[model samples]
Target chain A: MEFLNQNSLYIVLIITVICWFGIFGYLLSLDKKIKKLEEKINKE
Target chain B: MVFKIILGIGLTLVIIAGIALPMVSNPSSFFELPVVPGLEDKARIIFFHVPTAWVCVIAFITSLIYGIQYLRTKEILYDIKSVTAAGLGFLFCILATVTGAIWSKFTWGAFWNWDPRQTSIFVLLLIYGAYFALRSSIEVEEKRASLSAVYSIIAGLTVPFFIFIIPRIVSSLHPDPIINPQGKIHMNPTMLVIFLSSLTGFTAVYYWMFNLRVRFSKLLYQQQMKEQE
Candidate 1:
């Protein structure tokens, strides 16, 4: 487990965090944009 | 629904096994390493890197199919589908690049070596980036769809060459020269089960994403049309 604590572990954690948030953020933004469009359509 | 549930279970099991593989002792360990203890044994990256590339392959295949459909039927839905798939494909490409970069940093001393495989992926990114730029530049919907579809078909052909062919020809610092020239495998039965499980799980996730993106694009397109009317 000691080897896991080296600099690479930090690097991997950073990569994983970036991957997690980046993907979810895009998905959420796309959903939000679609919802706004739908709301506008309903108003019209 | 059952299939999705099964895939979820499979992904869970695979992830557990992947996490356990390095920790397991004796014959359970796939191959012993001389490196420092518990070096994060790279098999975990299979959960990430391979899955991203698989999703990208799936996305481009989808783009090409819809590209042809748009050309044949001239249906706006198909055009929307093609562009949406390409857009998602580009995102997957970026994901794959980042994952690969991180993996390289650990295995290789540096992250961005100008190796043949790396160079080709960079080129692939350029090709897809240009595709989106081409779409955004054109104001006319039909014209944008037609040009982007054609470009997508041409660009889709580059994927196999970059992902498969170039990697084979070049001497990589990667792994498994004798067994895995065709994208390293040869995991023991236990590891193989875990790897396959992850692949199935990711395929489900990919479809889920594709469905959502295509639906969003269709909705947006319809809304735009209504506004015009």
Candidate 2:
């Protein structure tokens, strides 16, 4: 807690990075799902 | 495959360098960022915030290009591309707005100051919001495509005016843009490199998302056609 109080910018950086990872993970999953759907449609 | 790997690594590096780098009054080395007088630590927001706005503009311009193609070709695929691009633009625009608003609360003492830049982006959100509303209202395929294409072209034309022109013509509390009236970037070379890298990385991510969206839309269109048969 004392360390974070002294280095608040790192907190912001950590939050920003977590948000970016969340968005990136969502995109990757969406990409995988789309690929699966494309395969299913092609096989139909 | 190689492109995605490089992009992932490059973007990760950009985020780390943009945020974690030390800011100093005098940057004697490559690793340190020169602190802007009015914005010290907060200046770091530029690497993240500006890229969202930049991606919004790129997505809007892409939407405009696809809109023109749809009008010229009268193709449903082009229409799909245009709308997907516009949707992505809207998403990025909202991201920019939210990020800017958060930064504003800390810097400007208020969340909503109605500054020229803020006002202009607000108006832009409305304009693009109406585009989606117009799209949803029309059920007919051909008519919807033609009308929305024309609307997107007009909306895109206004983007530069709102984002670039209006913010410059009027004085506001906003900091000088990277490309200011003096036409000089007053940034440390290290900071400039990181900024540009962030812009390139975000634009690449936008391209990836746009491809995924367009492909999904195309697949949905095909499924609908099959159902209609």
Candidate 3:
């Protein structure tokens, strides 16, 4: 516990959060583009 | 929502079953550490890097499969699926590269060493990237699909050589001979669990993303057609 606290726990946490977020954002945006296309297809 | 909940439960079970078991054992737990020689510790990344890389391989092969399917049937659906596979494959390739880079950086010092493994994966990325570029370069539908199909097929042959063969040839500073030549990777029960669980989790993510991408790409193509009309 002491070692975990004195060390870079926060740094690791931040990096992980950022990495997952980047992945989430990327996939979400791609899904949005697909949704937009679906609407266009429906209109046609 | 229901399926997501089921997936969540399944993933939770996998983590608990595989990761938690190995971590709790003392003698076997150290198997997780980097002190082991022959880079056994780095083999931990096998769960992430190898699976993701293989998933990327699957993605590309999928693209090639559909590309050929398009060639035979000339169905627009097959073409859309092919491009979707390429896009998702490219994403996994990026993930594999990033994970491998970080693993190499920690084990071998520099973040981006020009080692045989690193160089080959980078080249693979370039080849796949060009597949997209070639598709875009041609405006006509059939022409674009056929051209990209040829490229996808050629590019895929390099994947096996890059991911497997070349890394073994030179005296690599990287870990060696665990995954290959069966009976080499003798993992303790605990480490095996975490390793296997991670592989399963990553594989699940790969399939979900692949499905989503194919659905989305179909929409994109239809949108393009709608606009043209």
Predicted model with the maximum DockQ: 2
- Model 3 lDDT at residue B21: 29
lDDT of 2 by residue, B3-61 (tens): 77787778888888999999989999999998877778778888988999999999999
lDDT (tens digit, per residue) of candidate 3 on B1-229: 4554454555555433432222222364444422234454455455557777878888888888888898889798988788888888899899889988998887788889898888888998999999888988999888888888778778877778887888778655555435554434455655566566656666676777887867866666666776899
TM-score, chain B, model 2, is: 0.97
lDDT of 1 at B90: 81
**What is the CAPRI rating of model 3's predicted complex?**
acceptable
Report the C-alpha displacement of residue B158, candidate 2, in angstroms.
0.3
lDDT of 1 by residue, B1-229 (tens): 4654565556555555554434333443454322222334764676567777878878888898898888888898998888878878888889888878887887776789976767878998898899988988999888988888888888888888887788768876555423574545444556556666676777676776777777777776777787899
In candidate 1 the C-alpha lDDT for residue B50 amounts to 79
DockQ, Cα level, model 1:
0.19
What TM-score applies to chain A of candidate 3?
0.68
Q: Give the runs in model 3 whose Cα sits over 4 Å from its true position.
A: A1-44, B1-3, B9-35, B38-43, B180-185
**Predictions ranked by TM-score, top down?**
2, 1, 3
